[model samples]
Target: MYGEGDNQVKALDEVSLSVNQGEFVLIVGSSGSGKSTLLNMIGLLDRPTNGTIKIDGVNTTTLNDDKISAFRNTKLGFIFQFSNLLTDLTVLENVLLPRQIGGTTKTANKDATDLLKAVGLESQINKRANKISGGQAQRAAIARGLVNKPSIVLADEPTGNLDSVTSETIVQLMKSMAKRLGQTFVIVTHDRQHFGEVDKVITIKDGKAFEGEDDPSTASGKEMEVVA
Candidate 1:
């Protein structure tokens, strides 16, 4: 909600959905459809005016700012459309940034290395972020997002900046990694091709959410009950 009186607006109106552990969920909607808002809510970046968000069985709505920040740092991971890596830092260093901020650097070195290797960025580990290609940079970003071993990883149009082939590759890599690590992924993307790979597809319209079917093509017509 924003503004007052005549200018008041509800960004999200009773939007509800559930994401099971180890599930690959895709969120699709047009611009200004509240897709990002829902993601922000699930990522704990923003709190709702009403209702509760339970992640890994923890009710985040009741946490104070300090506790929320700590919980977010430890339980939530994010991958954006842009890699947003530090240009001056090496790939390895960028991946370890979260751990450094969280004061958990003891085993982070090895964990970061392993994540980079998993994402096929091991060869570029020592290279400066500015020197890597867009795909490599995004891969590094993926590695960075998983460095903390967060409960769920939230990605916003991760393949939006890549070519079709690169986009397919990136999605496959994400899916494979998710399967191997048993990590849950909630991604917001415009690419319909990704629907085939995800465990669930959520469509957001006018601040409302609806669950889709298993088959991507037939998902639009079939809607499931929204879970609060």
Candidate 2:
């Protein structure tokens, strides 16, 4: 991207990443390091400036916006730093909205309440979206995303709004749920401590990805590091 003709920025340059089912991957990068840009590309929120993205092993750049949106609704889930709940609606209503709009499920209401319970919010089921803590709101957002049982969940700063302790709890809850549902998770964050549950942590630097050996920074580690 160009700030001006004389000052252009290569937000993401030749970055390739591959994720498999039931894998929890952490993406770490400081601000302006193209972390969110990469996430946006993967989330199908925006097309890449160059290169291509494949979901379910199908190339996506050639698909129209409606097709991409449909694919996203059916195949991918999204969690942002903010919960983005509809403040006027109840938690259950907010969670059910996606399925209702997409015509994906006949039982979104029941699924919403069940997901709320899973997130430790059974009593808050009827609570208005504005009446919850940040963590609770984010949990409700999680429920919204999973209402479709998506194949991949892309989270951009999923725990950015909460305190460190709450962030840990929230991340762990997500990890446990991903394991149970066999969902793939890709999370972007600047903080590094709470990712002990992640399978791998890939770092972005200078418009490219960090590549090294083991996650312990060793070459002999069993897991192959992908970002380069």
By lDDT, the best candidate is 1
User: Lowest lDDT 10-mer window, candidate 1?
Assistant: 219-228
Report the C-alpha lDDT of model 1 over 23-130, residue by residue, as the tens digit.
999988788888898899998888898888888888889999999989989998999999999999999999999999999989999999999999998899999999
Deviating ranges (above 4 Å) for candidate 2: 2-4, 211-228
Query: Poorest 10 consecutive residues of model 2 by lDDT?
Result: 219-228
User: What tens digits encode model 2's per-residue C-alpha lDDT throughout 12-74?
Assistant: 877776677788888876688888887888888878777778877768888899998898898
lDDT of 2: 0.81
Candidate 1 regions exceeding 4 Å error are 213-228
TM-score of each: 0.93, 0.90
